[model samples]
Target: MIGILILAVLAGGCRGGSDSGDSRDSGHRPAGGMMDEGTAGQLPKDGKYDPVITLTYLRPWGPDVKFQEGEDQDNNGHTRWAKDKLGIQLKNLWISPSTNNAFETKLRLSLASDAEMPDIISYRGDFNLVRELIESGKFLDAGELFDQYASDTWKDAVEEDPTVWYPYMQDGKRIGIPILDYAYNSDPVMWIREDWMMKFGFQAPKTLSDLEIIMEAFTNQDPDGNGEKDTYGLTFGFKNWVNTWMSDAGWVFGAYGTMPNQWNLTEEGKLEYGSISPGAKQALEKLQSWMGKGYLAEMAGWYDEAKAVEEFTAGRAGIVVGPHWMPAWPLADVKQKVKGARIRAYPIPSGEDGRAGRHGTSIANGVILINKDMEHPEAFFTYQNYLFDHFANPEVGSEFENGLAGENEEAIADEGDQLTNNAVHTEGYDSEKYTVTFDGARIPSLNMATLLKLAYGGKAVTPFEKKVKSGASREMLEAAEIVMVQRNIAMNQMFTGPPTETMNMNNDILSRMEKDTFSQIIYGKISIDYFDTFVEKWKAAGGDQITREVNEWYRTVNEGQ
Candidate 1:
């Protein structure tokens, strides 16, 4: 399940969108935006289509997105730029708000009814839907089109992690172009209460035993100074899944060498279910011990990710694990509640072997498909190329950085001495999200690498770097440094393709059973040996067949590569 990632900064500002004087054509080839003479019917020189080209797509409108009084989805600043600057016209076939999965429902119905398909589709959720679209035979070979039309920058970005193409591959042809995003965006790091650490005279944990000692102190020592036994050592939610984006307990399993709820590669180079591994049993034993010592919250089994984080934010827990972005979010609430409260990010504690591992994030968040019957297929590439070249990482003091001519001065003035001049959206408008694809465009690893550079005393000379420096806090910089230092240990999920037949039939039942049994063992309602019985039952209930199917899919994809 890949959720759409909202970029921290708007990728494109209001620079070229409003200034391009080119006019739209009533026909396919308009007189305003044209190609060079004698190059007719061929790829254009500067991505300008010459005669205007119309690319149609369905719009998944966001509830939070606002439009200027005179502008709309069809006549916004971004759409104007496509018409005048790039000689492309974006046509929305229909509009559907994103709430309640409205867009996905419409698309599914379209597929089932064989409705007229748009020229291109930018989908950002559900790999299963992507697979269904590809299997429908309504889309073209995206790899072929990309190779033939994509700019060097676009090609290089996709090549950064070639595995991004795995999910969209069919019959040895890549049928979808992945929408790239920053890597390691959700990998876990340790966040500890600095005031509590100082009160307890503790240092950063270097090993699992060290972490345990800190947890015990936090649980029993009343680190909050309220003189009540209400605080816990560490906080995480395990009700939905052990491994998750927030309030994650994957590090706990990582401490023992496996991450539950994600497929991991074994020593023999075959994919295996992490929940059934020997390391998982060992991890369960350790969790049971922690439960006995009351080191974890008593409400863990009932808490989801949001509920679990409240344990830390309400100042009832001393530690929480999450991504580097925590300081900018719910974690910041602690400062307003606890006087003189200080929080800091640190590396995940090593296990007994002096090593650690945690769940890794994917670089590509969504898939973009092209309809086989569409005319002007290359126009999509041209529009995306322009976005990647300019807005992906805008140059300092450029029009993109300066924004609209009038608003530029005020936006720059707000930076103070930093001279951060990134463009600001017009009131009631965000031009980036109004483009053909959500969040406009991005280059994988660019944003994080820039943060890492600033984290270690590197200069912020570029606009992108300055933007990062202006937005990131000292704690976030330090967290980025810690994240990079532990990058090698990230255990990325290996089975990215759609679920297999056995998985479709038995996954829900197996997942419930696993969660129930694990929680029972941790709560002491069942003996640790019950794990052995659970594993045997899991195999009998289709876990073995699912493993075989996953490996077979893995082998086929790898062999295709």
Candidate 2:
């Protein structure tokens, strides 16, 4: 559910999200503007190929991906877009699962069976799979095509961090383009019921001991005032899943100075899995103890994130951990699910030394690969660069497309006759909508401040901001502000080293073994001391090899620098 993360601009400041103190009068604005109606040097715009370029693709969709009734894989908005606007026709070679693991499995099976891969393929963050795909030599080295077709707007945005290209770089060439998601967007924060805390006359939990007491009160003191033993102190889904961006207990490990789902640099300057450390052992022990005391659900480990959110929605759990966007999602659901439920976000609590270090991912690790046989790699750049022009690039033409008179910068939309950026269309492509929903790459600096400002007062900054402001509750608006203010403070992993050879062969087994051990310990199925044995097995099972490769990568990168 990584909704359109409207970056530093809204879907307008003259164009959209990148990072900000949104001063319309600020010296900073989208660069390179002032256009004549027709420039001789300007190349052909992205739309309606006369001969029509047809692209075959594999669909890796999520459960949330929906079409407007009668519309589906080939005939829906984006595919129709191929036939209509981009002069490209899209063909789905196969549609993979919207469920977790299903799509990857199907994709893996396709690779194994040597099924013909599509022209364009989008994948989630599976570095090993991507590495294998590139190694198979069935894909294009997109470097040359990218440079030729990428628009100035897209080029400028990418300049913010060229290293985003790291994950897909093979033998010094970009084998595929990296799909960019917000980096700190997955960073965990402690979300608690400030309303519940106030009701119980409790202070914010500043340390581990304080948290225990708060959980105690939440479990037993009836914070909901229902006078029943129905509520729990703190709850998150560690049930059937491990760490994810939402409904996760990763912060439980963070409380002990590490987190699951990442690698950390050791004092000796080597990389190590954060989940296998002493910090993890202690964290699991504490969670087991808390479960014993009835501070969490007995089956808490089985709950996927959404079910865990239902606990809060149903007025049962008091605290949850996730990134900033929770307010827009499961938290907001609390209102529809229960009239009195209230929630707020806080900085993830401190460890013994006051370090509340949380984990983060790289900006552009999920992948976009072009097939080697595709004639026009530039087609992707054309369509996506057009997405940059209307949706992401708030400064491309130097106006916000704002409805207000100088309240927000008046945006200059591309004003192309064929289409706007909207995804949904009506009337057999005769069209009722003004834009299209093309997902891939984003403005790296998309800031939240101006969007919040839109909520506080004045005209909307961007149409995107306007919709966001209209939809947000006061709680959401406030939570967004807190997340934005504290985002820079997060401790990013800063490691995009692809899976090493041993890692590629052993990651699934190792990851499963790790999650099983952690889960069993938290559910009191094993002693905390079993972690020592688990660590031994892990090292014996190629963890050592992974460490060696990661260090080599670290050394190579640093030496080059």
Best by TM-score, which number? 1
lDDT of each: 0.77, 0.64
lDDT of 2 at 322: 80
Going through the candidates in order, what is the number of backbone clashes in each? 3, 37
Off by over 4 Å in 1: 1-46, 62-75, 402-410, 413-430
> Which ranges of candidate 2 are over 4 A from the true structure?
1-48, 77-84, 100-102, 125-128, 240-242, 394-441, 447-459
Q: lDDT tens digits, residues 237-322, model 1?
A: 88887788898878878887888888999889999888988788888888889888999988888999989988888899989999
Per-model C-alpha RMSD: 6.1, 7.3
Per-residue C-alpha lDDT of model 2 across residues 1-561, encoded as one tens digit per residue: 011233334334423534332322211211122222432123233244556766676646655555567866677544554466556676777876647777778888888999888888877645667888888888987765666556665666565566677778787788877665544556667788877888888877877788889999899988888778898888778755556667777767776777666777766776667878888888889888998899888777778888887787777888887876687777777767766667877766776777666666456646778899776555566566655654453432333233211122222333222212222222123111111222533555553544446545535445544434444556656666655555544544645756677877998899899889988888888999999999999989998888778788778877866
Give the Cα-based TM-score of candidate 2 against the true structure: 0.81
Estimate the TM-score of every prediction: 0.86, 0.81
> Local error of candidate 2 at 289, Å?
2.6
lDDT of 2: 0.64
Best by lDDT: 1
